[model samples]
Target: MKLSIVDLSTVIPGETRHDALMKSIDVAQHIEKLGFHRIWVAEHHGAASIAGRAPEVLIPAIAANTSSIRVGSGSVLLNHYSVFKVAEVFCTLNELYPGRIDLGAGRATTGPITDFALQQDRSKQFRSDSDQQITELVAWLDHSFPDDHPFAKAPIHTIDSHPELYLLGSSAWSASAASQLGLPYVFAGFINQKGTRQIIDSYRSGFKPSAGRTGVKSPEVILSVHVVCADTEEEARRQIAPVHVMYDNLARGIIDAQMPAPDDAVKKLGGLPSLETYMKGSGKPPRFVAGTPDQVHEQLTQLSNDLSVDEIIIQDMMTNHDARLHSYDLLAGVFDFI
Candidate 1:
């Protein structure tokens, strides 16, 4: 199976945003050298723990720093912006990076408070905007808008270079949309870890072809999940401790996105009355996999086989930056991704 990475550029305690960004570049270069397939930077506005608020700005830096390995926004939340502008920005990125740019689109909303902060007001039409945006964005890329379409008349900075488009979704709604649009789809398994078998099957069954689109004719799917691989099972579990803390905090309405230090997580968990109950996984989904190289490989292979996906993108979330890089390095060696 093909392997890729989705770096949120998680900001650990005591690390500034600058540090997180620099580390993103460094990790990009490291992964390129290690023979990984791609590295996608995430977009999370108004979140303290995630430093990558603007993946478009980071794409050029990452592409320039590495000779290969595709770079992209794991997703640009399309609901908040103009589809025309999104098309222009990624067209420009494609011109700069040529064959290495990917335009992955999603519908995640920055909380209503942040939406007001950014002056991104939403009318009732906002719910349906994502489908329209994706359709228009693809037309803009191919310069294929209907002749009578306003955009066809005005044009949006015509360009020959175009980025490959992928729809990012956690459920069947997005999956069906991608299939119908003839675009590649990425399932956010880490977010919607349950009932995935039906989701993927539904996507394939709903697929419709758009003439001359190879991805549409023979759909491609990628699965993104939280993973941590270490030298041993015990060590890997220790590495993911902080990740659990971060998730627990978020579920409890804590806004801090900061990754706590491992020791800090241990101490903090002692007082969190919900920690024990949460770990017991009563109704929790299987959202993550943490273990030694062999163990992780087995689980990942099983997941890929069961879902029949073409690739897997690891969402790197380790508390320590070095450990994060090490995990990818180990996965590369195990899978011979190079």
Candidate 2:
């Protein structure tokens, strides 16, 4: 099974955002050591949830600490930034890491508004405008048209090179675009996973190879699932409290989107319909690969078999940095691919 690691440890509510930043490099290096195929960092903005919206800045530092594991963006909200800048950043990373960088581009408002945030105001731009712009934006980077060629007036142009790019989404809109563009697809569940089967089916079925494209043929699909691993089933259930609390916060209007909770508090996050389903499972969450090594392996194999996924991107947002690092290690032991 092809398994990868993705960090979405949103700064738990009330915790200092710097806390997550400080541990990111270490967590990345440690996960790499544990034999993960690729380490992807997420992008979210506005609130204090995740400090990863500035992935161009974080990916390089993570790369500097790792020797071989591929480093990529869970997604860079393409609408809010310039393709030239994105291309330049990834190209630089590729030059340093040499074919070990991936640019997973996304369409949503990666939340937080930055001084120079990747996601701009949603109210101002037309919905899907960014996605469409990204379509054109990507072309500019892949190959610069002749000086007089069409689309020369494009808003975001780049000297395309290095850093293989992938289109990411959990919906059919992204599927259709990625298929038509012939770029690899990363379907992220961290932000949204509903309609995934339809999305992937549409992606694969609608996929028509494009020779004129600059990237690989017949887009590859990566299903990024939320997961946490531990030694025992009981322990796995106990540890996922923070994650449950985080999701619970998402369910309720608390909207703090920060600070995961302890096990005691996870019980308070009880409004979710899926929570009961998850609680009833033998130490696992819906669409989440969480449990003991054996259980996790079974879950992963099930996921792979069902989706025919080319890769599985994991998010194990344990309570602390050390816990996260440990989860990474244990996950490696669980997956044979590691």
Candidate 3:
């Protein structure tokens, strides 16, 4: 199985967009050389850490810079975007990058309550069903799947085929949505690990084939993992300190926690009660892929089986280009030949 790399190289706290984009481009280009299958950029709004908020613009920029790596919005929050516009955006991207474009749409807007509060008026309309929203997005894509309607007309660049579309869901809500619509489903193994098996099971077992999809043949369940491999275990641990801080910030409600200092986060959320029950049921355990390539690879080999994962998506929290590049070098040794 080929492994892919996804960089949530969000805008570090207090960093400018220009700086973040430059850093992201550097990372993307380096990973392309590293032979990652696809490089996806996530979209986040109202947060300092995430800068691809305007995926409409950012995705193309990143796609323009790289040649082979697949580029896409890790998701364009479906709830906040119009179906036609979202379809248009991905269709446009497909035109530019051809088969390298993917549309990974999801429900959450990346925050707990902030997304709920930002909606224009849908606070009550069609409330509480991310599955429905995902379904509608698929319908919008298939709007012209049956006939070449004017508005639904495929862009000239999108002539031969539509972009490979996938649903991004953190919970089980999208299982039915993706299966019924005949689209691939990507679980956000990063945030919530709850009911992942049941969700994947439901998606695989309940899927029905369509002209657009391969018909749920062992649906693609991409697990998000934090990896920081090095020559030695101690080196790996020190490098991965940033990842733990990143994790704490995410769980502690710093929706935009890109690279906050570990000390600050420890002061805020260190020693909090363990949500181990939740961890056992749905979420993945802490993934600090810091170790010799051999050790890290062994752990990931077991991780794939433990999670029944079809594909692994690594999110490198390391900031330094050389350091992450070194980690990537070790990672290639581990996952490249697979």
Of the candidates shown, which would achieve the greatest lDDT relative to the real structure? 1
The reply for model 2, stretches above 4 Å from the true place, is: 12-15, 110-128, 144-160, 190-194, 267-285
lDDT by residue for model 3 over 123-200, one digit each (tens)? 464344566456655655555344554545545332344677888776766777778777777776656554656677
Candidate 1 lDDT, 1-338, residue by residue in tens: 88888998888789898888999999999989898889998988888788998989988989999988899999988877888788779888988888899888998767766665544564433343477777777777667779898878773355566788889988778888888888788988888876466777788888877563324677788989888888987677677788788878889998765778776786777632221111222222257777888878877887787678769998967778888888988898899865
lDDT of 2 by residue, 1-338 (tens): 77787775466445676767767777777777777788888887665566665787888888888788888887877766766667777777777788788888887743343423333554564344455566665666666455686657566433545677788887778888888777788876545545666777788888877555355676588887778777776667766777677666767756555555545545655532131223222222265566777777777666666777767888766665555667777767767535
Pick by TM-score: 1 or 3, better one: 1
Regions more than 4 Å wrong, model 1: 119-129, 155-157, 212-215, 271-285
Greater TM-score among 1 and 2 belongs to: 1
Q: Estimate every model's Cα lDDT from 0 to 1.
A: 0.79, 0.68, 0.65
TM-score of each: 0.91, 0.84, 0.80
Clash pairs, model 3 backbone = 11-49, 193-282, 193-283, 194-282
Clashing residue pairs in all predictions, respectively, total 0, 8, 4
